[model samples]
Target: MPGRALPVGLCPDMCPAAERDLRERERRLHRLELAPGCPGDPPRADPQRAVKEYSRPAAGKPRPPPSQLRPPPVLLATVRYLAGEVAESAGASPAEVVGFVADRLRAVRMDLALQAAGDAEATVVLEAALATLLAVVARLGPDDVRGPVDPVLLQTQVQESFGSLRRCYARGAGTRPRQAAFQGLFLLYNLGSVQALREVLQLPASLRACPALRTALAIDAAFREGNAARFFRLLRTLPYLQSCAVQGHVGLARRAALARLARALSTPKGQPLPLGFVVHLLALDGPQEARGLCQAHGLPVDEEGRVVFLRGRYAEEGRPPASACRVLVGSKLQGRTLEEVVMAEEEDEGVQAPRTMQEGDAPSPRVPGLAQTI
Candidate 1:
């Protein structure tokens, strides 16, 4: 009676509203998984694979990830169908909306595991969530890094993995793990190629910077900031990074060419080929060097502890970020609207004033409200 507590009358009436809401949102996300393009929504454990258990220094035994609660692929693809849901509800970027929705969904996940306080499940869940969330950040953050992410719970493992990541992928060892780190993981370890990593990273990049690098500098930074599994895994891909560096540009693309040079000389993959064939090829330079390095050395991997490749798509399977709406237009006509534009019904385009460019190349009075370029 001395301390404040819920009034006796407030204790029982219905289920914990917060808990109930959490469960409901999770269920909704689950249902969305049944749709197309969402990856492994009702995730099944791989045939020969199981979630690995990690041992904490305090607890002598290994622990499994608690709340193995990865949201459905629709979570990401929500930008297609359920984006309005987030705009109506969260009203932020696709990543932010997803973050909000995921936050709520995770809340529900946490409630179920609420009693598992200070256990391995709790630690793994929190860590895995953070790692996965960063993967989302990579896909949604502003320009710089845009890449894949692998979550390794161990701090030391993160260090070791970071060493490997710098070696394997072309990157600086001391950077943050954001969009770029995630993108690198997507290509080398998870998605299996730089092309796909490019697509995902493009989701949040401001504009298309042509001829993508082997590993994004942003990625290098992220891994440094992330858990050890990422770092060590990165080390495995150094040779690929080196090859990109060696194949320098032929005078064009100063930024990209410089990035390539940095990758080659960064020193994570291995010692400089003071007299190595790869080094020699780099000196010769160009697309031919890239081709030569591959034929000569085979991407510097000798089949030791490779990431097996995950099949699911994170964005389509989970809640998409708020920014996703920018691209989700219904028809060429109305120019789709989210919450902010909800109150303003767009008028017919034909009725609008004729387009004209002013001195500053700004749209002239011919166009009144919308900003149009010549």
Candidate 2:
């Protein structure tokens, strides 16, 4: 009698449980790949590494108690929902739907941030949800979907949400080059984080060659060099996704340019700038629009169609300057614990703490331990 030769993966000396699990996963994936109408998951260089990268929690944050964290399940649900939407949205416009999905993703992201410095587990979940969102957004054409809200406001939201994700998840995942690059550019243009964009460019050469990355880098250079004309030109030629992604920040950028123009052309009291000059500087449609913008911001226009930007005037009027008032709302208190709300209410009411019984105080309880001590 002779011992039989074991198959390579089935040997008892190797990991039997792991080999079985691997086989099971491969079986499922193979079924998925062969299934009709199943848009299977994207090709990964190493699927197991992908799983580990996402599942392993980043150190430095306390692992949140399982009961307190919803990101894993919530993001899983969101990914499934968005994947379905992406598959079914063949005839409909994707912009609004994508925006809706982005909103949900952002909400989950904010919730994760508030609870703790999220671990890698949460980031992995969020990244999966974001991947689905990116997929939906990628399917959109230039005019296929219009912005769901004011473009400027949406840019602000995307900046915060996407930037946070890039920081938490993108830094660790080496497999998501294209998605990471796009998100990095999104954060750079909307939030103007040069450091973030640079880091993305410093990624593997394969990713740096992305057209979106190149365009974003050019825009950054133009902006940094004070080449407003070039900046605007590059902005005009942004890809469909980049154009939509940067739309929200365009108004902010224009306003900033207007402020710079005002500062450059400032003169002593009573000096005025021609309304046409103001219009051109602000890139407004006409003198009337420029006049309206000036009036709204306390930059008064004279009867002769000349405008004056009074420096330090907002301080004199006991109000914050316009730039200071562009507040970004981070989150609402709707999800806060009832105890937090009660404590806040108590503080507002100036309630004092109930006095505790001191050692000298009377103890009249019928409890065995306290009565015996007394």
Candidate 3:
């Protein structure tokens, strides 16, 4: 009896093993409604737990385990279901499948730059998280989608969030339905990949049907390619970006750049502004007649609306045929009057006190008969 070991099951496993079992069982079981007496297994974080970990295989990394590729088909099937659900409920809950894909994707490698490791990691994690959304959306097509992944806050931790990306289901309990699709579109727009954009465009006609964001994306693409008319056309079509107040600065910037070019193109400039030459840059091939002129500092327009150039003057008679002084709007004269405009100096006069703010320098509030709104 002294030489023999206690029976395996009869022996005490000791403190360490017992403690581990105690810790592992700390989770609470999920309660079920339909099953009555049945208790669901406790939620175990394990791999699903968000962790700040990621790796890219050396120069040529080996493939991920078979489990990595498991999400595509399954998530794709869920998207197929969502296509019909939107008509009834806007979007169904198979969205859960997208979470399934997103949670695991955080483990995948991405082609991120090492120098900006933290920022890049943040971007990739969000991307992987959002990529799952695409699989579910792929079934609906791009037309039906409308909305952004994140709401515009006066201040947010980041323009888009990395945290929302780590968990596939932050949208689960109180998640908004159209949010995933809207976010997917925003991410796609910023990707800068024309081919990828085309892929996004291939989504269901329903998802693709939304012109609001699509119009904005089109404007962005046109601007990136430097196609002014296309950019203006898209802006005119949607009209939402004006209030987006989110990208207003960016919109104003592009408008300024294009306005300068339009001025040069319509005028008899002694020389052409170099950057303005690539009018067809964005693959937008339209004739000179197809172009329209907008006032300076004025929001761009396709119609003769209440828009006024910041100079607070009336819009010119439809981009004055073709002229020389039109090299750019003679905006330098906006707040000045002919009588007040400083002309030639009678050099013979010592009467010029150190030109202080004279009556001539005072700004006039309105320039009489201007038809435009500031």
Worst 10 residues of 2 by lDDT: 324-333
- In angstroms, give how far residue 101 of model 1 lies from its true place: 4.3
- Model 1: per-residue lDDT, tens digit, 56-148? 224454322222322222122222122234333332444443444334334323332323232332322333333332223323332212222
How high is the CA lDDT of each candidate model? 0.28, 0.45, 0.30
| Candidate 3 lDDT over residue span 1-374, tens digit each | 24533221111211123322343377421111012333445433222121212234566665333222223222222222222222123233333322332222333222121212233233333443333333332222122222222213211312223334423323344333343334334533343557546655655555444443344355455456554443433333221112121122233334444454444333332222222222222111222311332333232333423222333222333323221111111222345321111111112111111112123221123222211211
Which one is best on TM-score? 2
> What's the ranking of the predictions by lDDT, best on top?
2, 3, 1
Candidates sorted by TM-score, descending order?
Answer: 2, 3, 1
Task: Report the poorest 10 consecutive residues by lDDT, candidate 3.
Answer: 344-353
lDDT of 3: 0.30
Error of 1 at 287 (Å): 11
lDDT of 1 at 184: 39
Local error of candidate 3 at residue 161 (angstroms): 2.4
Q: Candidate 2: where is the Cα deviation over 4 Å?
A: 1-184, 268-288, 302-374
